[model samples]
Target: MTVTDTHTHLYSDAFDDDRKVMIERAIAANVTRFFIPAIDSSYTKAMLQLEADFPNHVHLMTGLHPTSVKENYMEELRHVEELLSKRKFVAIGEIGIDLYWDKNTLEIQQEAFSHQIRLAKQYRLPIVNHCREAFDEIFVVLETEKSDDLFGIFHCFTGDIEQAKRAISFNMKLGIGGVVTFKNGGIDKFLNQIDLEHVVLETDSPYLAPVPYRGKRNESAYIIKVLEKLSELYGLSQEVIAAITTENSKAIFKV
Candidate 1:
């Protein structure tokens, strides 16, 4: 049962002390494929090095994260453009409006989000969306960018059935993570209503750890808790949940 962590910052400094040990732990638990999302140029080197070290298991995505979109965002997008032009990546992602951090930069966030969406479409790549406190804002951009060519995962989904349906309408697969294991996470309430094929599992590592590890640092291996929760919520076995979500991930990443 190989589980796919669709979005995780495995290259994050949070795991610096024991990165290899942490990854081996995940592999032992059958949580293998690690899709690393780009935050900015600052982490690009680490990301590439990580992929080189774990060439067969690490998949990469290049884009400007919403929170990283600041005064010189154009320069950052140029960095993203240069990478896309020169490398092979699974997607253009972890990009979208994040009003929760800096409401003042909403306009620029939207602009960057739209620009990256175009990049994804142009490259025929899937997008890994990161939306926080800006569902309406995100939907606004998705409304305009809607197209057969625009498809991706709504990373770390935290929405109701209505919103899940809406996200699907925009060609996105919902990324379910540790939040599904939280007592008040809410997605569990209506998640089963949405077909398993529309959802994928993730841990958003070094963040959003599942129940036993909630409020502590998250890691890829902990994704098993998420898979277990989905199994209960969907009335399937842990093995089945892992297999289906892994297959759902392959459908999105085409790996």
Candidate 2:
């Protein structure tokens, strides 16, 4: 099974000690494709270095993360624009509203989110969204930008069935990760209700690691735990789940 970790920060400093070993561990576990998301301009060099190190396995995206939007956001957006104009990226993400960190930046976050969505449309690329505690806010922007041209994966989706349907309505595939394995991680309870076609798998590594490793740094290798839980929920084999989700990722990233 060729598993695709649609959202992972392989360039994170958290893996400075053993990034290569960690990635190889994931690849050995069948998690071969790693789509790297941009947080801001500062991480761009590291992301590019990661791609250079693993050209066949790593795909890069350029965008300003909502939390990274601060006083000099215009400058950051300009960096994103410059990157897009210079090179090809699989998508324009992981971009979206994130209110968990700073509620004060909501306005600018919405502006940045909407702007990136337009950039995605302009580039004819899918977007990988990063929403946290701001589903309603995220939806408002998405609603205004709704069109056949707008489509992507809602990275680390942690919403209810209604929200899932709404995201799907906007042509987004829900990105399932370690959260589904938690006993209290609610999404697993109703995940099977959603068609597998509208689902994709991700690790969001160095962040939400799956159960048995929760609270620890997550790595792409741990994605197998997610695949296993999803199998049990959907009454399917791990290989099938991996295959389908990987295909769903391919449909979005087109690589």
Candidate 3:
């Protein structure tokens, strides 16, 4: 079976000491696809270098993450436009409102998020969203920008059934990761209600590790743990889980 890791940061500083080993471990576990999310211009070089180093396995995205938005967000948005002009990216991502960290720049965060969503539409690419304690804010923008032309994944989704339905209404898929395995993750309560085809697997490496690895650094190989949990929740085999989610990812990313 070919498992797809829809969101991972292979170039994260957390993996600097053993990036190769982590990737090899993932590959050995049959996790064949790696989709990398972009943070900002600061991580552009590293993301590109990662793709260059593993062209077949790694896919790159370009965008300014929500938390990365600040006073001079226009400058960063300009940088995003510049990168899009130079080459194609799988998606415009890891972009959304992040109120968990700071609510002071909420206005600027909304502006940047909307701008990037338009950019994604303009480029005809899907998006990978990063929302934390700001689903309402993020949904407001998504509601205004609702169109067949705009759609993508809500990365690391940890919302309720209502939010999941709302996201799907906007043509977005819910990205499931290690949280589904958490005792109080909340997602598991309603996940079974949603079909497996609407879900995608992710690790969000260096963060949100599954049960056994909770509080520890996460790697792509650990995606299997998530797959296992999903299987138990849905009463499906690992191969079926991987196949359906992989197809779900391809439906969104077109990769």
At residue 127, give the lDDT of candidate 2: 90
Per residue, candidate 2 scores C-alpha lDDT tens digits across 35-126 of 99999999999999999999999999999999999999999999999999999999998899999999999999999999999999999999
TM-score of each: 0.99, 0.99, 0.99
Better candidate number, 2 or 3, judged by TM-score: 2
Backbone collisions counted per model: 0, 0, 0
Worst 10 residues of 3 by lDDT: 190-199
* C-alpha local distance difference test of each model: 0.93, 0.95, 0.93
Number of the top lDDT candidate: 2
**In model 3, which regions exceed 4 Å deviation?**
none
Q: Which ten residues in a row are the worst by lDDT in model 1?
A: 224-233
lDDT of 1 by residue, 14-80 (tens): 9999999999999999988999999999999999999999998999999999999999999999999
lDDT at position 83, candidate 1: 95
Best-to-worst lDDT order? 2, 1, 3
State the displacement of the C-alpha of residue 34, model 1, in Å, after optimal TM-score superposition: 0.6
